[model samples]
Target chain A: MSWEKVFFALLIFPGLLYAVPTAWLMLWLERKFRARMQGRIGPPFYQPFFDFVKLMAKRRVLRPSFDSIFMMGLPLVSVSAGLLALALLPISSDSRGFAGDLVLLVAFLEVPSLCSVLAGFASRSIFGQVGATREAILSITYNLPFLTAIVALAYSAQSLRLVDIAASPAGGVRALAVLTICLCLPVKLRINPFSVSNAEQEIYSGPATEFSGPQLAMWELAHGLEWVALTGLVVCLGLTFRTGTWIGDFAIYTSLSLVLVILLTILATGTARLKIQQAARFYWRWGMGLSLVALILGVFPDIERFIR
Target chain B: MNIFSVLLKNLRMGPATLRFPEEVPYPKGFHGPVKIHTEKCICCGMCAYVCVSGAVRVAEHKDNCEWVYSPGLCTFCGKCVSVCPVEALHMAAKSAPSYFNTKALDEVHLVPYSPCPECGRPTPPVREVLRAKAFKGVAPNVLVKSLICQRCRQKDSQRALVSIQVKGEPPPSRSDK
Candidate 1:
């Protein structure tokens, strides 16, 4: 097969199929993981699918004053953007992998979150308004450190192509850039310390309170896909140990992804939600500082050579 | 010491939350409502007076005895039954009284009292329940009286006998009066 066909078959098609179950599975797994951490028995594996079916059977009741059109539009766009971003990630050496430039992938990954803020804002309730503001602030703060780290890597590699960057010189400045991306995963996924927007206690599920029935299901599906996609992206950035074979690469990548998912799920369960301002402060002070240091390390090859 | 204690404490679990609507059992000591044994009440106002929650309201009209019980205010203390001179009150384990309005809590009942057919004496409800309990094993069937107060017993007896002697049958006594 030609490289273009290989890319479409390997990355885009599998990525699309992978997005559905991965999102659905992550949601069920998250509930189960969270329950285990909190010393409770959570729902079963098919719980998320059951929840979607149950929601589909439910009647939708919109508040008279709510902006129904915008509320309906938000979740659909969010999940589509997440799945599209997943399609852009290069999980294997394939034809369609080059379709998504790293910059474009980053922009697509952010669309769902941006739409979340819009969803919250359109509801016009006090809680919804506050939640939208929080989501907007968090998005800006987390994405800054994230994009800075990505740009630093892109600068060093001389290519915004994700596969090309992945195939770059291993165990060098590129390696640190890859690690920085790994650090960025949890923030993009909006796990603890960064989970100010959807904190259940402080905001009553915040941006998602007014979301119910099918719209709510879409948001949940997006969240699940986003989880697996972020983890897959981390693995794609050359964080694997393979013997130059497809089977070896697949085994290594899948194992590493599973490990990363487990670690993050544990972290999510262990931590409590922080205030919005506290989260912003954390991202600005520590998150930005660490990512900047990584970026600086990735840029200064002479320093790396001198140290070696 | 601290580390071991912390580990042990974390290992210890919180109160188990009951599975609602399925594995849930009724709570202990669930005294739902007050039941009246009409013959046992003496109209002494003791139940009304002694009740700290004021759950029971008793009013003795000229011809009728009235009893009002508020299930909401009643903590199910069972104090009213204990203080009842005539043993009129019994704790209803099942059948709780419930309503949307607070005013609906006031449910009044008119207790039935049996006076003696011959003597016309009032029979206390407590004594009757106790008698029923005591004699159930001994007597296969027992007819108990629950009408007329203790004072009217002799008058009713004399009037009955006199009517039978004069009319060669029983006569109605003081129909208007």
Candidate 2:
């Protein structure tokens, strides 16, 4: 890709401009939906943006032992990883299709959580330490099923390229694979019930406790961008419907994401936060179980074809 | 009960939060600030006495009777309103608005005292004294006697006791003590 194309993809098209705002909007939607469910008036549409601005305006404070450079840089690294993942995803059937992009996307998806772990360790706070440990354990618990679900999708499409996956018609096994992904997304996103890593009530924002000012703002931004990337991935891999025009395709993609977001919000509001042990057990049992079934279903192409 | 069902029910019912500031309707009987009707207030000091937070101050002097309320210190318990003898105080359903400066929150209402009929000295507000008399079930004659200043009233009481002693009647036992 040319430098201009790289810049456009990374900073404009599917990167900072597109991903950041969309993620902020999605976070706002989650808050509003949850508040409504609890019979309360939630914050306005601009609340997320306001919070970001407020965080940016705050004074930066660093601990004596912490490396300021590493602490500040990790959030950017996470955001870049998410943007790269989005760029790798072919938005339409005619878009570029790279080999083994699915594997690359999965690896990129893990970077944000890994960054959180590193950040937590770097902070040297007790809450940060505990939060990092929880995140590490959660990453382990959810990554297997998440990756397995993706592999199941790949097996169904017979290609690791995202474009092929989007182009193919979704069937029973693929639908189950999508369901497995849907279940795991909440855990990955740290939404309610599966929000053991952050566990705000217990740990006071967990891994993000010590980060302040621009660093904290970037972390929040990275989280939002990650939301876009991961949800966009789900939409691309599971709910993509091509139209001849880019606008139509983009609209469908956004609409599907809205549906997924609504579903996730409802689930979040309905359930209480789970303990770390409970979360692990839940993933090991239900998460792993569903993905295993999807995997079994995907392995038998004849069966999937017959079902279709 | 499934959470999904609860969520669905809540969605159907809509939000429970009021659109405050734009539509400032509070629930019925909601305890807010203590509202004083200065005209009805007899300065009986019941509200001041009952106030737990020391937000109410009823100062009755020779020259003036003042009822001061500090909204900043008010607990909004409605105890003062409940204890008011003449129903001068009631809990308004609107809270005190926040102020940038602290001094704005303190409110003072001063009612000048009425002169004593005989001694021509400053006394408690006439309306307040009358209300207190009525609330305490004092007879008209006793109410008249209570209008005198402390020194004159004491002298009058002493003269009455001497007259009673001369009449060979035992003075009424000091029940107030």
Best by lDDT: 2
- RMSD to native for every prediction? 8.6, 4.3
Assess each prediction's global lDDT (C-alpha) against the native. Answer: 0.70, 0.82
Q: What would the per-residue lDDT of candidate 2 be over residues B1-177, giving only the tens digit for each residue?
A: 987888888888988876655765788998877888786776679888888989999988668788999888889998998877667788878777888875688888886766777788876644654546453665556567666766677888888788788877776543333
- Looking at chain B only, the TM-scores across the models are 0.49, 0.70
Candidate 2 lDDT, A1-308, residue by residue in tens? 46777677778767778888898998898889888888888899999999999988998885564478778889999988988888777765557657788888888989999999999988888999999999999999998888888888888788998778878786776788888888888998998888887988899888998899889989988888778887887888776477868788778877788788888888888889988889888888887888887788778878766776
In the predicted model 2, the residue pairs found to clash are B42-B128
How much is the lDDT of residue B128 in candidate 1? 53
- What DockQ, on C-alphas, does every prediction get? 0.10, 0.66
For every model shown, what is its TM-score relative to the native structure?
0.72, 0.83
Off by over 4 Å in 1: A1-13, A62-66, A172-175, A242-255, B1-82, B85-122, B126-148, B151-177
